[model samples]
Structure formats: structure tokens, C-alpha cells
Target: MDFFELVNRRESVRGYLDKPVEREKIEKIIEAGRVAPSACNAQPWKFVVVNDKAIVSQVARKLYDPLISGINKFALTSPVFIVVVAESRNLASKMGKLVKKKDYTNIDIGGACENICLAATELGLGTCIMGWFKEKGIKNILSIPSNKEVTLVISLGYYEDKEPRKKVRKDIKEIMSYNNY
Candidate 1:
């Protein structure tokens, strides 16, 4: 698909089919993320792709709240969970963050995550980048080091619903300016 069409097609898929995503497709999605540009080329990101049903269930447990109805319940049905981890920043990225007063790690990881989602969309798969999850639980389950942090969890699979949802967004005129805001 064209870039514009891919962008339009990409959405947060909450429901997924029972079928598992192919490993080859998953690897390509990860490759896309791996090549994503980072601040100062500081690719401080690690991805844990959980395909095992048992491990996926364990990861999904961190996203659910039995007491709260409809709280990330859709995650349970996803066939794969890609845990995005933010590793410790290198010296250059650290200095850049301090000088610019910006969280470069978060920004870099965001780009990588976007790449993962876009790649998945291109591969005829669906993805949902989830921020609402138990970070500590996930880190423990994945055996992530204490220094590195769990950035986000992307649920991946085939969309259960065939209908396409319309995209809602601000117009270019409203969101863009010629030279200045």
C-alpha cells in the first residue's frame, strides 16, 4: 500500500482473531522498528516479542483489571505482544537531553513504535500500542533489567472485525501554519 493509504489504514485494533501471526511477518515488523531513526543515533530500545501462548497470557494479565469492567480486556485475545523497552541512554543522548531539556529516549522509542505499527499494517496485521499496563509486572515477566524501563506493549494479530473505522482528525488548515504558529 502507498504511504498515505497505510497511514489511513493504521488504527488501534482492539479486537483480534484467534489465528497467530507468522514469525516472518513479525520479524519484518521488528526490522522496521530496528531501522527507525533515533536522537543522536541513540537507539536505546529493546523489543521482546512474545509469541508463546502462555507467556502472552502472562503479559496480558498485566493489562487486565478484573475489578474494572472493560479495562484492556481485548488484550487477552491478541496472538502476540511486543514489549517495547527503553534502555539506558548513552552519554551523547544523556547530554543532549540535559542541554535541550527533552526526553530523547521517549521520543526515539515513539518513532520505533510507530515503525512497528506501520510495518504491521503493511504486513496485513493489526497492532495496538498500549501504554496502560503493569510495567513492573511486565518487566519481571520478561526478565528486563532494573535500569531499562518498559516503554509500551504493542498487541499484534489479525483484526477480528472486518469493517474499517473512519479516521477522525483535525484538518491540515487547522493543524498547520505557513511559517509560524
Candidate 2:
């Protein structure tokens, strides 16, 4: 499918089949993230692919409610879970010797996450990007280093159910402007 069609078709998938995601496919998704542009080329993202049922259950248990409730359920049934981490301090260091903030790393990682999501859609797989979770618990569960910040969790699998219809959005004329609002 074309990029625009893929973007239109991509939706947050909350249900998954029992089949395992192929390792090759997972690698392709990861590669998409790896190649995403970053501020100053810091490339501060690291992805942890989790397929073990035990880990998935643990993650589901720690995920926050309502926003992530559907994702938690999907995690339990999905074949893969990828945790996106950002090396905040390391990225800042690369920015300059006198850097004082870490917010840019989040932007860099968010782009990477979006790339992974789009790549999954193109691969005929479903994905849901999750940010509502106990970061400390997930860090420990995934054996992430102290310096790495957990940015998002993505659930991946073969979709077993259809996605809900796309919600209506404001027209571009209402939301966009040629100059300052």
C-alpha cells in the first residue's frame, strides 16, 4: 500500500491472534526504528523485544488503567512486545558539552516509535503504542540499565479482530493556519 493509505489504515489494534510474530518481521520493524532521524543524529533509542508469556503477563499487570487497559489485554494475547527506551543523558552529551536538558531525547524516541508503528502496519501486523505503565517495574522486568529511560511499549501481533472505524476529525481549515493563530 502507498504511504498515505497505510497511514489512513493504521489504527491502534487491541486484539490479536495466537500466532507468534516472525523474528524476521520483528527485525524489520526494529530496523525501521533504527533508521529514524534523530536530533543531531544522536539516535538515542534502544528497543527491547519481549515475546515470553511470563514477561507479557508481568507487563500487563503493571500497565495503567483505561488508556492502557485495552493494550494490557492485547499484550496478554499478542506475540510480541517491544519496549522503546531513550538514552537521555547520553543523547544530551552528544548535543554539546554544556547541555542542560533531556527533553529532545523524548522527541527522538517518539519518532522512532512512530516509524516502528508504520512499519508494522506495512508488514501486515498490528501494533499499539503504550505509555501508561509503571516505568520502574518495566525497567526491572526487562533488565534495562539505570541510564535508559523507558519511553513507550508497543504490542505486536497478527490482528485477529478488525479495528473500530476511524473517528471524525476537524477539517484542516479549522485546525491549520498559514501564520500564527
Q: Give candidate 1's TM-score.
A: 0.94
Error of 2 at 83 (Å): 0.4
Error of 2 at 105 (Å): 0.9
* Pairs in steric clash, model 2: none
Predicted candidate 1 versus true structure: per-residue lDDT over 11-118, tens digit per residue: 999889999899999999999999999988999999999999999999999987676785889999999999999887888988988999997888899999999999
| TM-score per candidate, chains pooled | 0.94, 0.85
Name the 10 consecutive residues with the lowest summed lDDT in model 1.
159-168
Residue 120 CA error for candidate 2 (Å)?
0.3
Candidate 2 residues lying further than 4 Å off, grouped into runs, are 64-71, 89-102, 161-164
Off by over 4 Å in 1: 161-163
Error of model 2, residue 20, in angstroms: 0.3
Instruction: Highest TM-score: give the candidate number.
Output: 1
